[model samples]
Target chain A: MSQLHLTDEILMAFADGELEEPTAAAVAKAMAEDPTVAKRIMDFQQSRRLTRSAFSMALMPDVPPELQAAVLAQVASYEADGDSKAGSDIKPPQDAWIRRKRPFMQMALAASLAAIALALGYFVGWQAEPGTGGLIAQLESPLVHHELNSSASGKDVELPFGRMRVISTYRLANGSLCREFQLRSSTEAAEAVACRNSHWNATFALASPISDAGYTPSGGGDPMAAYLQSIGAGQPLVDEAEAKALAEAGR
Target chain B: MPAGIGQELVALLPRLRRFALVLCRSQPLADDLVQGACERALANAGSWTPGTKFDAWMFRILRNYWIDHLRRMRTEGMMEDISMQTQLVGDAGEGPILSRLVLSEVQRAIDSLPQEQREVLVLVCAEDLSYREAAEILDVPIGTVMSRLARARRRLMEMTAAA
Candidate 1:
């Protein structure tokens, strides 16, 4: 191959291992014949390394618990809905005897009844049945309303259905107060961003449930994160600032 | 929901998150993308052929979702401020000044590339996808992938050298 024929694209392809064997062999010959060619190839390799190292932290951070739970929950729900090939083979973990004997099961039953009651009471204005309030109502329960009204940013409230935590409070460019909160229940979790007008309008909401495993409360897995980025939510209000905002808004 | 699919999906989370980070360039947004992709993957699990490459399918879904998101943001006039917040500079006492400056400059150079070039570069160089695989994921021609990757590298080299 002529010295001038070793183009930058060819060298990059050779460095990236995208070239065919014969072409690679020809490139190797060109590099051997020319130190500048070899150095350019080396620079490409080093740049790739630097690019990888620059974002290496992405791989290092732990997968947020909410995300893990979301995946597991979806899988479990799929399986439990009798869609899996192994659904018939696998038995429920609790047998009749265990369920009849365990006091924990009784407590669970009671808690479930209480949850049903709370859902009914909270959605009474919109719907009589539990879980029938549609997506907006499912997110805007009495507890969530109270939490949004009473809790300052960065505070958590333990409600009957789940734990609600106010992540951040900010004002939109239109001068309306917006709050991002996370609601985590035993079976599912949701993150929502609501902007206050006459009432809180859910600008965005996403839910990911836990699988058979019980609930665990953690932070930072929000499906609306990208939307929030688009909207340019600069920084969350700190404690004092959140308090001041809430007070000034007469909340 | 297939017998072993759950475990496989779980195993792929870390890599998926990394790829999402490469696409979105923000940790929280990356996680959001992963979760959204997982939801769609679960809902459409039956459509996935049994013997197909699952990772490629998932990556395609994520890329499509991101594209749709970008389109929506653009329509709403919300695209200009979507830059990822990276803390490139640390406290003066934290690290050597020369090394920190180099790192910051390298990051800025990478960030300055156009989104198309950045995506291809991340897929090919960072995620170790072959040119063809990156093309498949990005739904672009193989030659397009190669050209974009080359342009990204050339731009990075020029910017960093100038810095």
Candidate 2:
């Protein structure tokens, strides 16, 4: 059969291990006979691997505390209601609980960020002294270094000034790994990008009050997003890739 | 909820969370979806027949909840929240950065797929559901699942190759 004759559906089935035995055997025979067919099958297999790996993290993270609690609570409530009973009466007060909890969670996040920022400022100021390249040098302080090296994208790393969320990561044109993070306190938010060289360099940093709620990590409205775009950052490095780059940089 | 049912639901959380993450592309939202689905599953636990696949039933509930949430968001004009776009990008624990990067690239490629195709791909490729199971979860014909998976995989390859 011509290469074009092998439909993507058949190939996809083969990749997914969904092909029936005889058909799968036929495809295996054809693959052995045809290098192009073999290559296509290999590519399909690779895509399947990639697809599976991308979300594998979901399985690794400890179930979020809230979720775990919710599950246990449900089980507990059901048990309390006497195992056989079922209905709306036994429903966990999820809506009311969420309503009460969301604001507290938001405030806790805000306060934590604030405390982190304050401490970071004090330490950075104490270390930078005068004429040490100001904030750029401050951005390279040991705390920042530690946070950058240790935290993965989408995680909030506690810093002296506030909580730093490593929002996105990318490789620069020159092949250095760059991380874009948003540091936020109760009152302020700053978006900064740092690239690894011999050490982490604050390639760009911008801070403002929490007014830019409209700006997203990837949306064009955010200055950091624009900056990354201008620098031709093709795509952010995955968490593992970012960690490896940091290690290589001796961070 | 029956003790057996509760245990089964708890056991299925990880897989459900994985499916939710791929569908919503945001961790917070994914967790919310899972929580909601679990609640619904428990409340309506009697609807599930004995010996049926619990995972498929939960998946259907999760997908339905997601679709409903999307519709509500669209109605409320709240879909533009940038924070909603953030996705937790790596395993919480340790892994190779190169593999993670490749995974992230692959994820972005998948994220760019149309919703229909993306859901099918997630069910078959990531969740490892059989075509029949996926079709049932999606409430579509088996042929539909196969076609969507094919298109999704093709698009993913093209996008990643271009990158």
Candidate 3:
């Protein structure tokens, strides 16, 4: 090995163990003979050590709950789409995945609904009265109108019952448009999925308050999700496709 | 498009967020970056080679998003100030106070580096990715990775030592 001074890149690669054996041996021999070479190598090593120390995983904030819920919801939505498409014959290797994922999806969906409540500037105490079939009847026109025209980032509508907004729109396998929506009253909230036919029909409804606490969906999973599965719901439409869907429906 | 890619993505969120936070220096933007990258990764999961490093693939997706965002911001005259103070902090419930203090100082040093240098430093030093892996993620040559890593470390050492 010649006694030429090592470039910082060479020293760093050597320090990082990125150099080939022969080049690394030359650098090792140089380091033994030259104190400055040894010091330079030590600097690169210390810098990496210090950086790794500073940004230790322990320094990280807990992943925010909303972000976690959002990711879980995404995974669940994809899983639901796969389930609807794959059918009975294509069994997933992990049977436990189905068992473990449902409650989580429902919980995440519930949490997101509650988060929407917060985002919509509604307080948590107000609970919507259950079994208000007449309210659904009265809500039919505005809900259908909004479903036809509004984007998934829905506009807030003041209803006789409460403020309601469409959450998302999806197409079921049988070729019908379905929308998931939420209604918040002064003290309570509910989320429902309505599919279009001759008229929009509420296929699934959960009358729980739009709060994370004290609300677990019936059957240890979301009936809305199960209904979507039973009906073979596709993924939610993107904004552009959604606009096109609305335009076609309007025509 | 591995069977467990979704779960793998979930596992990587913390480190992904850390890298984003280090690069963008904003918590909200970091979250957005990570979320956008994950969505892109899932939507185009087929494009990823089955046996390659999943983390590197994700980092590239995230870095591309960051680049696109910066381009959009610049075109729209909404360019962010890169010198924004980072929100990194030790958990109040854990770690020694000295580590917390050192963390802030080191974070400041990292924030002071150019974006290019900071990214290479984080990938190589903090994330423990090899030079080649970092180069692949950055879409730069291996030599560029080496030079950038050297300059970034030297600057970081100078700044921290001075502090």
Candidate 4:
């Protein structure tokens, strides 16, 4: 059995600060004498520094106060609704996400909403639907039966784009329910809103993908872009109650 | 199971976000991932056992969930856009000393790396997880971890260099 030297594993350990005193000491000793090895180590550190800096810029995104409020309400509901293991299944809120371009735009959207809210004299809280508006909403959506047929549980919900893992759920003004779901692939996640009207019209009200899990969604690849585009593109934004509720909500 | 795991999860948000940033490069998704893991941990708190580091346990769950998420993404694909790293580089903003260098060239290089190597680098350098802990979190043998780390670092260096 040959001893481990600058093996990829050892380098990884070194990078992670995992090497024990003796082992790390050995790697350190090797790196000192080996300029190539030392340079490699430096490169790793640089990646860390740069990556962290870029991502850190997006920690607090611009989440709409209404959506935030909605999430808060739904979160409360989630807490009160169950006790399988309190706090064991909690999800982070929209505001807490690490953001990049999404924060700025989300903030812009939020600002616009706030302006509208103030104009209308309605104190719309920020945040979106947590759980398909309500169970009723989810079941009624085009994707509802599809979702349930696939597996619409607390953990994972099947959607058109893919299987959406339920991060949280909330209710909306138009009798539409919504919840944040992460698509199975990539860093993209969005809220799907549906109303409990026996024919729940669940739609990807909006979607955004993070850099990973820390940064906010960008505008281009954002599913929200599609939904928003479809709206302006003459595609009716809502099928039934969601449209009405969105109207009332000034969305 | 231990008490106050929820509080612990709340505290872990920052670090977890950082790790997720490296893995997926998106904040919302990262938060979603954290929430998913938190919810899972809370639901399965009984399995955590007393005396275990809640942080590690949560991380293990998080890493597991993250892997599953990745697998799903690979099969179904996702909305495509300029990778976040590219968007950052385009900024060229006159920010702090560090932020300037965080632009696209290096990030692209990192992105180009294989998933295994990228995961190791993020877990180790970015997240600062020790080898043993990373191994546990990744559900890989220690040797496999070490090798992955080495390969990731080497590849990172090459990618960062003039291409």
The number of the candidate with the highest lDDT is 3
Worst 10 contiguous positions by lDDT, candidate 2 chain B: B91-100
Error of 1 at B101 (Å): 12
The total of clashing pairs for model 2 equals: 14
Positional deviation of residue B100's Cα in model 2 after best superposition, in angstroms:
5.0
Computed on alpha carbons, the lDDT of every model, listed in order, comes to 0.62, 0.63, 0.65, 0.48
User: A1-251, model 3: which lDDT tens digit per residue?
Assistant: 35656899998877666677688778777766655666566567557756776666656556677777777777667655563222222112222212111334333333333333333322212122223433344335664555445555476777667877877788777778888887777645566677777666665554444433332223222335645655567688868887777666556
Off by over 4 Å in 4: A1-5, A11-16, A21-37, A40-251, B14-32, B49-51, B67-104
Per-residue lDDT tens digits for candidate 2, residues A99-145, read 11132322332222222333333111111111323333346677877
Worst 10 residues of 2 chain A by lDDT: A122-131
What TM-score is obtained by chain A of candidate 1?
Answer: 0.43
**What docking class should model 4 receive?**
incorrect
Better of 2 and 4 by lDDT: 2
Candidate 3 has an lDDT of: 0.65
TM-score of chain A of each: 0.43, 0.41, 0.42, 0.31
lDDT of 2 by residue, B1-163 (tens): 3448888888888788878876776777888899988877777776665555667778888888888898899899877563356354643432343234433556678877877898888776666667777877787888898888878877776775565
Q: What is the C-alpha RMSD of each candidate to the true structure, in Å?
A: 26.6, 18.9, 25.5, 24.4
Ranking by lDDT: 3, 2, 1, 4
For all candidates, the clash counts are: 0, 14, 6, 61
Clashing pairs in 1: none
Estimate, for each residue in B1-163, the C-alpha lDDT of model 4 and write its tens digit: 3555555655566666556545555545665676666666666766665554556566677777887787777778873332543332223222343243344444566667766777776665545455666667777887887777767656655654443
> Residue A227 CA error for candidate 2 (Å)?
48
Candidates, DockQ:
0.15, 0.15, 0.15, 0.09
